[model samples]
Target: MPHPPVLIAGAGPSGLVLALILLKNGVPVRIIDKERTHRIGSRGAGLHPRTLELYAMLGVLDDILNNAGKIVPTASYDFGELVPKSTMLLLKYHEATPDVPHANTAALNQDRHEEILRAHLAKLSCTVELGAELRSFEQSADSVVARIVKTAEDGTQSEETATFDWLVGTDGAHSVVRKQLGLSFLGETRTETIFALGDIKVEEGLDPNFWHMWNVGPKMILMRPHGVTSTMFNFMLKGRSEHLMNKTLTSDEFAEEFYSLTDRRDVKFGEAAWMSNYRPNIRMVDKMHQGRVFVAGDAAHCHSPAGGQGLNSSVQDSGNLGWKLALVHKGLTPTDLLDTYNEERLRVIAHMLGLTTALLDRNDRGVGEPGKKEFKMHQHGDAMRMLSVNYRGSSIISQAAGAAGAESDPYAEAAGAPVQAAYRAPDAPELVPAGTQGAATRLFEVFSVSAHTVLVFGGDTDARAPVVDALARFPPGIVHAVLLLGQEHAPPSDAPRFGAVFEDRAGHAYRGYGADADALTVVVVRPDGVVGVVASNAEAVEQYFRRILIAV
Candidate 1:
């Protein structure tokens, strides 16, 4: 009998990423898209640091950084010049952020970004079947069966059939996969058609390092330097006309507008690589998962690109879903864990929506310091809190915790009793926890790989000695056991289960898992490598495995 395929719909970023992650974890997957070929149009143009880190962990960040456009930084304030401003405003405002190593964002269009991802997918010995379109699906007790039709590059069409244990809808905003499941996209489409985007060549004189924006009037224009070229720029115009939303801007029309907007007829619009009109809308699917199928990226939730959150949030959505789905496939976790993706992601999306709205309407009018902070809080949130997306408050988290004792201690910095001396490297940030080698070249190398890491946090070998004894048997097939200890400590290399002792200065592993200076901390990470359980004591630690892994 043939093994059930993990069928994926769509070959965009989300679908491709899900395929890459699952394949890396030893799961076989097949991806199909209706498009006859990859998109030549420049779609999304922003790549946040977190997404880059995920790609890096997948061993593909170098490809993106080397091939894509280098992102130039710009500062914005109401009625101020759109040219680059002092970094002090950004740095000071984001003072409380944990020092995660990633670009805040870079300017790489969707075409180039997906090209890099596709290259990586091909390197994995798998390829997407372009021109393949999903027709419908039926789910049985154990698997989902899907019907697909492939159109040959030579203009011939044929049918292909496949069955899978699971299916994911990454087919974008108008996803057929999402509709086939009968899920409702519960949100409102924007009433105003205020934004239009296209790519054009810049004039002979312009700073290549600066993002140019004109925000002084009702119509706002945002232009960014494209690629390594000084004479090309991508522009977005905001205003409404009856035909603005539907009419395709002709090359002459686009060129005329460029000169009018900049008040320079000398500026010419060269051949446009791609052009499209989009209206900002805030929409999210009421349900992310149903039966054995799931939705992600634009198929799950989409919000206004007020702060360029659409693609970043979608990437995050898929990243969260990919790890959980991988765990269930490996039999290390149950279906219940899937519910957490919606719980955690919905809350994050809500926060982002609020921020995008505020940034769009920043008047500095009736807005006091509190209002500004509220708006900017989301920006800071993106920089500071965005790095450590947690799975707590998730349905599967409690199940994953599985009776880890929760005796609250007032003196505790961690979840439980306090430890006298925990591992603290000389260079680890005092504020951001121990073991973060902030932004070093090897930073992602040490912390970003996908692994189910078990962090035993304690300096005193005696207190943590029990955990060392408990987890001393399993190898990499089960979990990656990491004993986080301070210096002035040593252990036998031949110890049974404890594989590697990762110190503080090595990377941000300790802080990433939300560790504290507790006497004994045992954290069980899922196969996608997100933290699952943080056991403060031995009884709680033993109960975790018994409930989730040991018991039926």
Candidate 2:
């Protein structure tokens, strides 16, 4: 290998996603988990719209969509009588559009999600080393010396000293890497809200199409079906349910509690698959990284599971850090780029903690959506969906226009909003290829997980040469050039080298990117599917890369 493999301390979704993204960028990784085997259960099941879009970029959306179902409508019950109506917790589903392809959440168990990610990583010749733990580490200027303990199948343990170029802590809340770094995990644990969650089987007369929630006196119980027809469900006991916390893990005790709460003896309880306890920990680390070591996912931030933000946020955290880490490790970009990880993520995480905490508070206050404004809570809004989350104020972002007032709202960018630099790049379909037999494609398909995509609109052969030439100066395979021309103009026969050329016949390419087709407009999409630079000419585009890439 050119450099020592990047050491990832955890093999959860956060770690696995990070390892996969780096592997896609040709960066070596060593993913380890302290657990002896894979975790089984639907611990966190709601995959938000933004998360689905990210999975598409990683080439895993097809498998995820094939296995998961849309968020099931939750059926609320006062004791045993079912409520007249039930609504999606993530809100009403929106039809998939060219700009927002993934408009609804997917209900896939965390266990199965990890399995899909691990299988994809294996295709790249990488596997999660189970039972191997990063016990401790010391970081120098150049490399990280880590002490790892590996447990064999025979229950014997062996310890070894290994060196890695970089270290990332995707480990959970009790992270060894974060503890070793001495970073403060600042904030309070919500003692008022604690719950027992597990995966169990309900082998009787219960509709698997709806998420069942029952309220007994002051306590709350929810049984969310794991899949459409599967007998498995993720059960959660909240509010005044302390009496059943310890007893739910044993024999027929859980069944007795369920019967007592709902007074429904028609349902039979079967063997439990996975079980655990959860408390609302509204907390985040003051800093995400120190020296060459870093923390992400639950280790970096943890909050209530009110809006199903924990798993999605963790995956996004790793995704945000993966591309930046790869660029710096490959010596293609300066280390200054790595600092943006902390800057960008901290802002988003802080806002998210507040949002999730508010949701929990609303649910406790018995505030509902509209007519049922009794306890069926609502109003997480588009922000909770996470598609609008942006880094418009980041130091690395560069733009000639279209982003003057972007920093006011953290979740400002959405499907219909103007394409601003440092925000998640929007998708535009109906781009007809020029002088080729290929069918029409979308901007989402052109975006890469391993390279930056440069979309050039409305520049002629002579004028487009500089932008094309400037991109060519950078290291090959790191930058992709795309030309989006108007429908009236023919394809440039003597044009400079371009990765793809398309005619904006439907005018979506221009409308989606918020650019006119009369002048040269360059929009650079980063490997993580973020717009890095929105410029008018080649000189400005070249300057943006100089800030990101070496020898540009």
Candidate 3:
């Protein structure tokens, strides 16, 4: 059977990752962006710990970490003088333990993040088609027909109609796909607050280690440094910003406003690289998908960038949908699996918007005021680090015995809760692969992005073949079975024939997953690095996947 390409609208982080995941899974994709050129600006610069873990799975973490900046402390000012560290609007950092490899947040421009994703896509022979806009789309019972407009270098435009198996709209807030689908995007627009933001060159006086901020009730100035030599910054100007948003504020005029706020003569502002205004139009659609057409990222939800959940949630949306779509494309899974993406992300995003909106409200209520003293009330804290985000209540997750998944607490992950089905699988280092002279690897490295990983913990050799056989009933490569043996258990000499066998000599995997070493437990992990099922035996593992994957 021939598979038609999956048409993706928008080339932002969401679209790029979704396209990358699909392409990597041998699913053809056509990713298009309406923009004529690559967008510039440090929009949505905060990258949470969980997003870094996604990047690690995507094989782009090294480049992202190397090129990205650290989350610098906000050198807040009360009237004029610099405030203490305790009072700073800073992002709190945490140490990386064995279970949590990426505990700290990363700072990188949204454009650069997209560029890294594009590079990864290129490795798979997939490139984003810029200036190719999906103007409108219509879906039938099986395929979606799209009208795409392509703009040339000379600015001439040509329209073409194409058909696809699936259409994903990552086209941002004003999505044509969503509009065409007529999905109800209901929410309130914060007309009271507006911010004039710019990416410009700052020649002197601003410290790179500290993000400079000046506090004035209803009026605030925030400048976070970026780019090479730390001379460039993403600056925000607030306070009756209606004039700024309405009037044509030039580079020089914007610079003058910066000087007026900072009252600093030493600092020199260069020409503006990019400028835009934001008022935080918080909104979300009732349904993320309608038939063959689906919406992810900004198209599905919009909110303030206070807690930095917007972009992270958008990327996570792509990951959660991509693999399932790939399975459906490969005819190895029922289309019903696609329903989980909507159900899982909708609640998560709703909770995320609530948190970010509350943060914005707190900032509105004088978190920036001089002598204001509430601990991290204005800062990104341990809460909402996005590490603990889970799909605990999703239909696909199969957990019994009254586990943490039954709690339905969207904030459970932030509380450092115990292991649960549909939770982000914890990472464990020092798992020595059976053979290779005891060379060790992390559990994260073993998980695949294109297949469901079944971890068989502390199982005897006699029970291993049945587990492998049950999983082999599915399409090859759709499922990966790995055996986790404790120190007391000796791996058989023919372990290579069985599958991946990792010896947990230090018992990190067992402790991390909260599984008994003496018990033969099976943990089925989804392609997005989430534990989908924790079963007591191989029969239950196969049964769990049967609810998701169509057996061959």
Model 3 agreement with the true structure over 1-552: per-residue lDDT tens digits: 443479999998899989988887889898999988989888888888888888777778899998887877677665444443333547766889888988988889988888888888888888888899998877888888899999998999999998888999999999998999999999999887888887988877777777888767767888888844678899877873344566646888887776667666667778888887788889999999888889999999999888888899999999899999999888888889888888888888888888889988888876634345643576666756888787876777886555454347665552333566777888888888765466788878888788888888765666666776687677778877888877656677547654588888788888888777666788888889888887777787777888887763
By how many angstroms RMSD does model 2 differ from the true structure? 2.4
Clashing pairs in 2: none
Q: TM-score for each prediction?
A: 0.80, 0.94, 0.94
* Whole-structure CA lDDT of model 3: 0.81
Model 1: lDDT to the true structure:
0.61
Q: What would you estimate as the lDDT of candidate 2?
A: 0.82
Error of 2 at 367 (Å): 4.8
Worst 10 residues of 1 by lDDT: 418-427
Error of 3 at 329 (Å): 1.1
User: lDDT of each prediction vs. the true structure?
Assistant: 0.61, 0.82, 0.81
User: What is the per-residue lDDT of model 1 for residues 1-552, given as tens digits with 9 covering 90 to 100?
Assistant: 674368888888888888888887777888888999888755677776657667766788787777676445443333333333331122122222333455356568787888888888888888888999988888886799888888998999998677889999888888877888888877776665457788776655456666655444555566677765656677787653455446667667666654555554544456776677777677777778888898888887776665567777777677777766776777776677677676667766766666666655562222222235533432333432244434444444433323222222111123332211111111123222224443433324433334655667664656777666566543245556666654323443423345555445443435554455456667665543344566776566555554344332
- Measure candidate 1: CA RMSD: 6.4
Task: Please give me the total number of clashing residue pairs in predicted model 2.
Answer: 0
The deviation in Å at residue 477 for candidate 2 is 1.9
Per-prediction tally of clashes? 5, 0, 1
The most accurate candidate by lDDT is: 2
TM-score of 1: 0.80
